[model samples]
Target: MSTRRAFAAACLAACLAACLPWYSVSAQDVRANGQKQPPVSSRGRLPVTGCAGQPISDIIVITQPPFTERLPTRLEWVRRTVRKTHANTRDEVVRRFLLMKIGEACNQIQRAESERILRAQPFLVDARIRVFDDEAGGVRLEVETRDDFSMIFEPTVQSKSPLVRGMRFGDSNLGGSATLAAINWRDGRAYNDVLGVELENYAFGRGRNEFRLSAQRHRFGQDMRLEFVRPYYTDLQRYAWIGSLGGTREPIEFRRGDLPRNALTVRREFANVGAVTRVGPVGRLRLVGASLTREVQRTDEQSLLLTREGVIADTTDVAVPTFRPQRVVRVNALLGVRAIRFVQVQGFDALTGAQDVRVGMQLGLVAGRSILVRQARDRDHFVAANLYGAYGGTRSFVGLQAVTEGRYDRDAKAWDNFVTSGRLAWYFRPAVRQTTVVESEWSAGRDMRVPFQLSLADREGGVMGHRNSRQAGARRLVFRAEQRLVVPTRLNIADVGFAGFAEAGRLWAEQSVPYSISTPWRGAVGVSVLAAVPPRSRRLWRVDFALPVSADPQRRFEVRFSSIDRSRVFWNEPRDVQAGRERTAPSSLFTWP
Candidate 1:
């Protein structure tokens, strides 16, 4: 037993060490001739005063491979091997995304927009566009881009005996074409076996439409989706459209107090098509669109037995009032206004990568009428509204988002599944390398007709140490705050950082359920080690150690590893509105224009 304990400890230590940031001498430390190098000034934008209206004389494209020759000699072999296998992005691919052309007059706004679009690509680490005087008196434009390590391999592990849980492998830039193809597989105690595949291309054809296809097979069922979209790729574009079809057949379980109380096999199918056009000036824009949607849902009577407190409990008799069969066709009108703005910053979400933060206000509303199939007289009216606003500068950022959606059944003459949610986030940088973030989220549901619920668990609303805590309810309130400090290092391969955080949340449910409205707030405190492969991957690798504030000794310590920073909030582009979805669908508050 002693020897086995020693072996386990060694294995755990090795695993943790492997996840740490790799350390090496910075490229600026020494010159090629072995002489100490001088520090360089910070990078800033070039002057655009006289070059704004000048006609472009020439266009030059420069691409950098992931591993450069400036690194130490010890990595020469690895660099050479990677370069041989990894294809540099095609010149045409970069040129096609550019808004400027030879002999065309240069505009600073277009140039800036081009840079933002190029940086948005997952395959590129950084992008810069500059204008200079040419020998022929015309302005010359230079575009430079650095490639990210396109190939990716991510694995999940646990602290238990079966340490290896799952893995995903893929190429974000297949053959330098800006295409993505990936596969994922997982088998673990908390989850059923899953296998999935995904394919996506942002520049599918001549118009640069986006295309995506995905399929997943679970132990009990499967799901598939296909989507094609011509998004507002640029602010100057006047039109956008989207078409999607998806279906799923799977078993869903409803749990309370860490145990499943009911299970049902559900099958659903949906299709949506929408189009929107810009309707106002560039400074103040309005979006108008309409969509048609069809949805069908069915559930099987068979119920799966689940274990409860070490005993198998037959859940067939459990009442699952949420699963109701329905077929509906709907039409919706979408209206939105945008006054959005952006600011570029470093070390906010991505360690050393350039990040664009969105600010200002965006509002959207969707109103629709649904016709129940096979029951011609049955009808319903639905409405959804989203609001987002933010203010960001060099030192501080504050954002607010809110959304509400529901349907009014004509027959019942009452509101069904009326739900509302809101979140507020604030970020403050006290020093150059230190940041503090605070966020609060609240959600409430009334007359809920579906199995949409909220929880204070880590994966749900993030009460860190209570990952498996099963406090769930129809009303939830959560608050989280974190402070982070970057540790300067010589290594160019990665950036390291440390953070401390505190989280508290409460859940409220009806008396008939396994929870109470008077449940006290639960809290946790934790520390994390954060690392990022700079100028390459956008994700941060994190390891957290947390402790619950409650009196349960068995839940004294909790450890977790993840690729995402839960404390940080990111800005996502607005999406087209669709109809016939439940109020519990993922909120578009932060994503709608």
Candidate 2:
């Protein structure tokens, strides 16, 4: 079949499945068909359990009237007519009747649910109801308060502890100049100086409400230098308020503060504040809120226009680009129904063109398995799906993942194209209680792509910014594979584990691109030994040896890896260099086991 036709079929299937009733156990009831049951009294009650305080006899009555007098009495007759019938058709008759009865009962119960709820709450002394002149079926209740109303708006008690820690190590140049140096707290040692100092508190008021206020400051270097970075001193203050009205299902939060990632000097000056409220029935409420913020960005001085040869030329001149504070309203919803005892949902909205929104959902199935769906809509829309499942025990697992996204071009009136990618990891015992693992990833897009890890220059010169080469003319494909191993305990005196991995793959720049030279292929091999350490600390050290067999556009083959963290070394041409000039890269010490 054609690609278009295949895609259409998949979309149809997803829509149909989503529209079906998610959870209705009555349809699946089979006991009524195979066995007899005791009758209930006219007053409506169930067999009691535990004690009298449980009010077991006062079970919520859910009986309803029959829709049709001629409806069949047999279990089979009921199954076929109910809106949601049991998957097993053996008790088709009874399942159908029970479902219809449930629908009618829900309507009657919903009508008087509020009154029933008020009587159920033992703390309520009295309540007042008010209705708006323009609205119907919308009743507002004011729980009479005896204390001050300001106390009711206070914040709730919450976990507000902030942790900060850092470490430093250095080996001085020996042989020629070895002299005692003063402890300046610059070459590491001051664990607290490199990280930061943070204090937070969430105090509650007499009305049983709470709010949080926090502040933090950090110094990057011992000298507290302000070069390169705009702010020499960083200060941030945050505030969040939460209160629960007696009639509401959950606490309503009034947050006048910054998001975790929005910590910046400009944000503190402008200040962003918002409130969120739930909009669903009891036990289920969607969050609706808004925030106002000012965004600031620094531009390189080289990018600025300069006079050269009496003509304007691009020059780098740092300038802070500040935008007026803008208000962005956001709203989202979530729903939960116990079927597999898991829930999945999504929501997104940006009140105006100046803002954007994104959403994601996930479903966890029985066992260690899960499915995820995510989408982001801003300047463009992108969607992806992934699945994760674990099968092996400690130190081993078989993982499979896949994702695809499309970038839409408004001016072109069409999506640039869709890119699909997938990866698989399989582990096996290669030695006594030891293991060797193999993994591979593949991606295909519009003639310009490579595996994520192989994008050596992604930080500054990623594939997306490549200079024009011939159009290559069709979709491209990139593939990569790696195998790693762990040695047995007998290999080392201390029983330390050994691991090694090698990877190789090809990049197809175009449908016609040759699998050989035209498509750059590379391979790498590395080995490391892990030492055992204390249970609560990751201070365990590792020594690694890696050789890069692939040559970059610079025509250099390198062989270098680091200890502790793989950031201070690089392989370049004929030299294995130590990159101590600056932070060359983030520590690659955290990887999945």
Candidate 3:
């Protein structure tokens, strides 16, 4: 068949399929007239898992609705025309983003992966893939897409906290590709105003590379960054690299008032280079190196303590570190093995693990040295290591990660300044659409990494509470359990439906800090409404509510009505196939964003 004729036939078939109930094609069977049906792999193929390839003889692009500004139709149309004219996300970019080509087999794994990746773009709101029967006995891959409003003008005055104010004006989808550019400014009564601007391109080099530039001005100081990444840069199709240079100048606030105003100012600069590659079939390796420099600037002010007179008083007890400049080198390593099973999905986003092996494991090592750069005590060689393991199935998922760091001093002749962190989690679905998850986490050390700290405060991260106080522990442990009820509904709203949850956690250190911990575990209970998100969203929506389990002297109740799910994968199998997936690439920052 001719190319155009083949596409025309595919279009006709797509029209038919679109009109049919989605469930109608869930399974394939032989026709009574001895016609063979496409073979259906009994294995489950979740969108998150991967895609299967069917030979493609044709390709189709289906553009869906656009998020036009609410301006008059004429104005919006003109705006859209201008935007589209300069769009880097043209049909060419979309084709470049696909793992499957016109002459190649239609890979469902890459199909879903591409859809998921595109959805993450700031400019795209929806991306869906469908395969149709072609006239040449080949498959036709159809990609349906919708673009988000590229430009946004946001002005805000937030009083939810202490009468804070802020505004952001930017175009998230600059030049039509997954590029972002915007300006943000905000301030409060203390002149705590912040101004920042950023430009990012996720589709540089046809989506295999990225470039970013950012600058921020804070009330106390400023920050800036320049980054570039070549996501896949190897003939083995198993390696990638990233380079970044950034710096920050900021103030650190201490608990005591005697430190005076801006008594200490910290400036830090760093440059990083990292690479990751698949070792064997199931194992992968990563190496990262960085050079860092730090300097401190201090000023003295009236000590807020007076004997009796109304004059500025002075009580001398607090001592500040001698201002110093330091430089160091940092290195990190990660290795992991992973395996997953795909079960046949019978319904929309339905997952059921038929007895199958699904597991993941990872190990990491970090090293720091300043001997080459500066002869400083703090820069002595230090090493950190971490391990993680997990198992997941349709109804259950469990995982744990542990880390430890220390430095061996020649004079001490032993490893000292040890720090540790660990986390464990288990989830089970007892019935259709119902899941119960239990999790525990802890951190402590003479010197701990940023993530090791126990976070019981509502602002610590995702876990919920009523207040906003961040506390740390030398060795702290927290326990959490929650139940999610998946209502039998589909679409963007209330997909899994709802959840009722209870959480309890505590933070304690080798040395106690006031208001940092309590003898009893702090517990809270709340409920939420979940949306049926594309596999990308993990089918979650707004948190709805997170309340304190009891009353406390500190009204530190923290509450958030919205939640956006960004998954992080510790150990991922490099093989992208449930069927024909592009080799899975580990994210540079978090997992899928």
Candidate 4:
């Protein structure tokens, strides 16, 4: 047999031997209340475990000064050479993103959160913190961080016929100050070209505050955005004050391919301020006030407003008539309240290079009214509620999230439901380097119109095996279960190996569309290869070949490519976390000051 085949045979034998239930429990949970808990499986703890009358020691945080640094690897050097530049992130800059401090009580969850928060920074590769015994009875922690090449210049281009393109220049670390600045361009043929610049200072000198400024030109319109944040400056980090201002002219397209020609134009000028206070230990509450002036320009294109089935002609074969164009300008005020709590479960270490469970949940309420919309407005008053939570453990991961909103129309004296959507994901590792995932998404409401409706299937990759899921739906429910088996590492070429997987999902919708799983349930069996792309640690590249069990001609055996395993939900770039590791689906839009 050839080398690859021989390696495959060896891998299968090794995996077969490694496959039994390897979950051997150890280390019972220890509570800080000085109480001894019962052991697992009806197995009682040995009587008088330690010296009688001895009290359990409490855990406190300590830092071992004189940290050791690992210099950049040769691979990093090669990257800099190729890019024609070199960049290093300073130690102090890494300290700014840490959520922990010296002299505080040691909380494993917080430690994990700190590591995760550190990893979230674009300039850092990862943070590694280790806990050790302290001579003084408290636990001490040592920290080490790996850095990423922080300065980059990106130019986005398109071959053949394309509509949008841009170029960007940025430095994640400027003079070791943890400041980020970028100048970019977003050129479009019909909507006017855009040139923009943005700057952000994570923290200036001795103040624990941050500030940001951005300005852009759209030819027909110019816009600017600014923000100021004072975290610890407000009340020893117990209170925070954040303020922002924005003015912009933007466009909303109506049809998938009818952009520029059929769209609504919007002009917005707004200011927002928020006050935040710590709630107890692991929670926080915030209130915000916002004021804005909004201008909306309407359009009356019959084709643009057509239903999913498209517009139909009259019985006499005459085309339908289009509505008259209308315009509206208004002033609005908004009040928002939000609360967040972090609950950590003592279990496993999966993503953040730390051993602690971090589950997060947030609740939000927003109320808004258009003072000038008066009688002709359908969105005179609005209220919304949002919730988000995610958990990641060494062997498993889960996420639960939802958001709902409603509006009260003064002209009609009635309440209109906007939309409500929720998602649930569960993952488990059946064996080493093996993964299984089950996930579902449900969205429902009366106002689920196009551009705001639920997407039926993900065509970005054939993980769901559905060839066509382009139609949007007012109500949608989709689910999938998939499994993967990784090849042994020894039988690889250049850190490359192959895997076999099978995935199947069903989509349910209100329309009698071809995308629904009710017809065939979108099943697929596939084989794929996963290999580490070096010059970067543990970054992987994947290619899949799938054979669909459906009758859709387009669903036949096809090839798909992705950066990571299709089973993961590591919301950030796959490069953010190590390969074959489980992690929470990150909420990337929000960043801490």
Judging by TM-score against the true structure, name the best candidate.
1
Model 2: residues with Cα > 4 Å off, grouped in runs? 1-384, 389-396, 403-412, 416-422, 430-432, 442-454, 457-495, 506-519, 535-541, 551-593
Mark the 10 consecutive residues where model 4 has the least summed lDDT: 576-585
Q: How far off is residue 344 in model 3, in Å?
A: 10
The order by descending lDDT is 1, 3, 4, 2
Which digits, one per residue and each the tens of the lDDT, describe model 3 over residues 1-593? 34334334433432342233211111123345976454343223222222345567655654432432343554456546644533334454555566676778666556655665555454554566777665465666666665544555666655676443777776655545556677778873453468777677777777556787777777656777667776542212355567776656654332222233212345565666666555554224343333232222222332333212322433545543332243445444434333322222111122211121225555555454444434333435556565666666656677776656665554446554465556677767777767776777665544311112233442432246634433433345666677766566323212456777777766555532212333345667778766533322232345557677644333244545543322323223111010011001123521212
Q: Candidate 2 on 1-593: residue-level lDDT in tens?
A: 44334334433443343244433121122243765232222232222211211111111222111111233345334423431221211122112111112213222222222222221111111111111111222221111100000000111122343222222221110000110111111212222332211111111121111222211122211111100101100001011122111000111111111211111121111122223333444322232332222211121222222122222332323232222221111121111111111111100000000001011221111111111223212232222223333344323445454444443433345653345555565545443435555656554443111111113222111122121111221222333333333234422112244556565544444432112123465455566655422110112235555555555333233333222211111101100011000010101110001
lDDT of each residue in 43-114, candidate 1, tens digit only: 342434545678896666766677653445675566677777676666667776787878788888788878
Please give the clash total of every predicted structure, in order. 0, 21, 18, 0
Report the error of model 3 at residue 593, Å: 8.8
State TM-scores per candidate.
0.83, 0.31, 0.65, 0.57
The C-alpha RMSD in Å for every predicted model, in order, reads 9.9, 26.5, 13.6, 15.8
Better of 1 and 4 by TM-score: 1
Worst 10 residues of 3 by lDDT: 576-585
Instruction: Give the candidate order by descending TM-score.
Output: 1, 3, 4, 2
